[model samples]
Target: MSANPFSLQSLSRTEAAVDPAFVFDGTMVSRAEFSEKVERTAAWLAAQGIGKGDVVAVWLVNRIEWIALLFAAARIGAVVAAVNTRYRSAEVAHLLKLSGAKLMVVEAAFRAIDFAAILADIARSEVPALQKLAVVGADAVPAHWPSVRFDAFDKPYPPAPTTQEDVDLPVLLYTTSGTTKGPKLVAHSQRTLATHAASVAQALKLDPQRHFLLAMLPFCGTFGMTSLLGFIAAGATIHALDAFEAAPALKILSENRITHSFGSDEMFRRILSLTDAPRPFPHLEICGFAAFQPGWRELAAEAEARGMKLFGLYGSSEVQALFSIACPSDAFADRIEGGGWPMSPDAKVRVRDTETGQLVAAGVSGEIEISAPSRFLGYFNNPEATHEAITADGFFRTGDVGRLRGDNVFVYETRAGDAMRLGGFLVAPGEIEDELKACTGVADAQVVAVDLKGNARCVAFVIPASEPPQQDKLFARLRERLAGYKVPARIYVVDAFPVTDSANGVKIQRARLRTMAMERIAAE
Candidate 1:
């Protein structure tokens, strides 16, 4: 295939040239109008002395203007460092300084949180690398800081389009994981990101007529960037939301006539549980889910009963979605027959053994690796990490366990790091923990497998809310949610799990509770 104009500039051009009157933010911003914002912002970016290859950190929630900054940075060829909107002073400061970002665009205040206060606490002066700061949603700019009035910034401009070399870097910066694990900087260039966009559009079957409202975070990670760009590529109308509250999201679906959306299984369950959720919008088409805990299919079925096509798409922070996607229309036999994805005729899938580093036979479980055009170049500034992730032959090691079938489809077994061998069958802890969360009194839970003299033992840790979570109750829940082998051999109840969030509400540490669980087990 030829190298198409797949960058933001080209995508903007397509949206404007084809669908000029498309509504964004309850008003139609003709393609020309949107492109003009891109230009004016690009020009302002140039004026701030931000040139190609520089980093422009964006710190804000999902909004039209937040997207404007992202496109603006792309147009100027600057890498957009998408900082989590929930980052507190220290976390925000660390990202801004670490990325060597010379400029930042943030919300002055939103909801009840004062972003200005958070910025002030971080102290820009402490980081000399930051030269300029722009705040939206505020009237009075700080004495020492520069601000971009959201309305004024949208004024039309006919600035010249940036050169090819100018819009090279697609995205940069680290994304915080579930636990306090150090953030890993994941980088992708224009080419890699565009490929991802193409994959999403193909998999979801999005088109110009389909409008999508995303409930996930608007950042550089797997959930936001890839999905948004895919919608843009499809020339689909993207309805923006500041955050995901089941009530408002359902209302948005009813009001905006949202046809498609994406979220975690937890979020989808909440939406399905909403008493006021619409029976089904005539325009509603698809609802893609990620990060399944367990009982996800039941929720998907509930959404399907309401006329939405629900699906489970697996992906990672390192490689934006589409590693594997389960279509809602697939029969139970199809799921058992190695699964399915919206694959082009040329796509390939393989399962390889972790121990021998060789391809595995059909129906045999092994590590799932990819040799796809859409995979990232590698992790940013960490060649060793990259080397471990990607193979000598160009395949990206997915770190996921799966098995191939005679039908050429791949069945995901579990995450390589999280799967345990129990009585000759592999047991995935996530599957168990997901089921445990469904218990009436259980607030949250986690499971880990310990190897003991050639045998595997499962340990489970649980969190109770207002009432004590009985082991028998938890066991019954597990029995209902999972197979016997996948159940934990033992269970431990805890007062609370360890978690840390940025001021903006980004989950920084997920595995901290696991460590705490291990410590408690040792003491016992």
Candidate 2:
């Protein structure tokens, strides 16, 4: 590969010309057929007036077409902004508007929410830059907007040619997990994505002989997106699922003879919980997951007993997905305990003192900062936020606390700020607190993450104005306002918050609140 590799057009052409590419649901799509699909999708996008440098928002679940549109956008110079399928009207509108998406490709509905209706409502003023809408699983376009059936855009047009210089241009914009605030768009180029994908594939020892099963994680997320691309780059067969269901996921893992897969500790626990009977996969070799806590360690042991090797991974959207991933040759303890080796030689990781900003000793834990070639360009349309994240000398502050050992392995400790990882997504307690404050009978709200059964669980403490808040009503409000993962597992109403006297001002002592939450849960 050169400094600027050939665009997806050339790569897909070469790969397809050599062998078949993807196997989804039970159907296998040959390389030649996949190339044709990409070309056809690119033609349709061009016909819709989407060309070089344009932004298209994709709101769909994991499927072959989602992957097709990703490469098709790369075939031209257009950028794809992935929207989380779990997002509601407000969340979807904010992403589309912030990314300045000119076109939106979405499904009619996933589960119960009518996405078509939501998109139609937001199209008027929330997302003014949006010009056209193409919907999948819909019979006809809705009235009162410029819309078209996703399949109707298939009128043939020639695939556009791309240059090496264009490969370095922005091609993908993914949203951060909103650890502190609302999600921010992180930009990446074809060069960065390709390099990162290849590095991950090499680290995971992926090959054409392996079959990958993707469940739980959505393609809109960095974790799933990079895994999909890395396996494709390795020419591996893919088995995709729109969502994670224990029985179906287990069936796929056993029936397909899946060799590799990725998921969260909770996801794996659920799959294992389905039955006490031994579920074995002789062909399954590698499994990648997050959160290497004690509970996760037991799960890893159980998985190993059944013939699959589980390893811990540490990364974020800012680092182009997996900055550090466990390799297959690593020891069982190291693979399960450490965050693995850095993906590239060009990537440097170091820890700094939180207050002094001085370099910490190699074995000392502190804030983890990284300088990598595969780092994202910056937060789109927000230079201030970008400057805040990336240091003056080009190092990106990961906001994660970890230590680098003597053997060059990184061990993750915890998040530096109020952010917590729940259900494999980095979430900010403030987001949940905001929703809680909006609830009736709530005067003030404070949220802290506490470890429950080895998974991060949000615990909300409320200060009521009138009377003690009802947990049922507050939970009902949260269900309507936020995603399911953001809903607090336990709620408590108190007269006042625990505070500490400080030189600056009185500050709420979250550590004490966390202790209170733990005691409450333990007592229950």
Q: Estimated TM-score per prediction?
A: 0.82, 0.77
Judge candidate 2 at residue 415 and give its lDDT: 68
Runs off by more than 4 Å, candidate 1: 1-4, 13-25, 123-126, 139-162, 166-181, 210-220, 276-278, 292-294, 322-324, 332-347, 405-408, 421-425, 430-445, 451-456, 462-487, 493-510
lDDT, candidate 1, 235-265, per-residue tens: 7666655765677666677777677777766
lDDT per residue as tens, model 2, 255-309? 8767777777767777777766565667777677874222456678887876667
- Taking the candidates one at a time, how many backbone clashes does each contain? 11, 0
Candidate 2's C-alpha runs over 4 A off are 1-6, 9-19, 120-123, 139-144, 152-154, 158-165, 179-181, 210-216, 292-294, 329-331, 418-524
State the lDDT at 100 in candidate 2: 93
Q: Give residue 203's error in model 1 in angstroms.
A: 3.8
* Alpha-carbon shift of residue 5 in model 1 (angstroms): 2.3
Q: Pick the candidate with the highest TM-score.
A: 1
Please estimate how well model 1 matches the true structure, expressed as its whole-model Cα lDDT: 0.64
Clashing pairs in 2: none
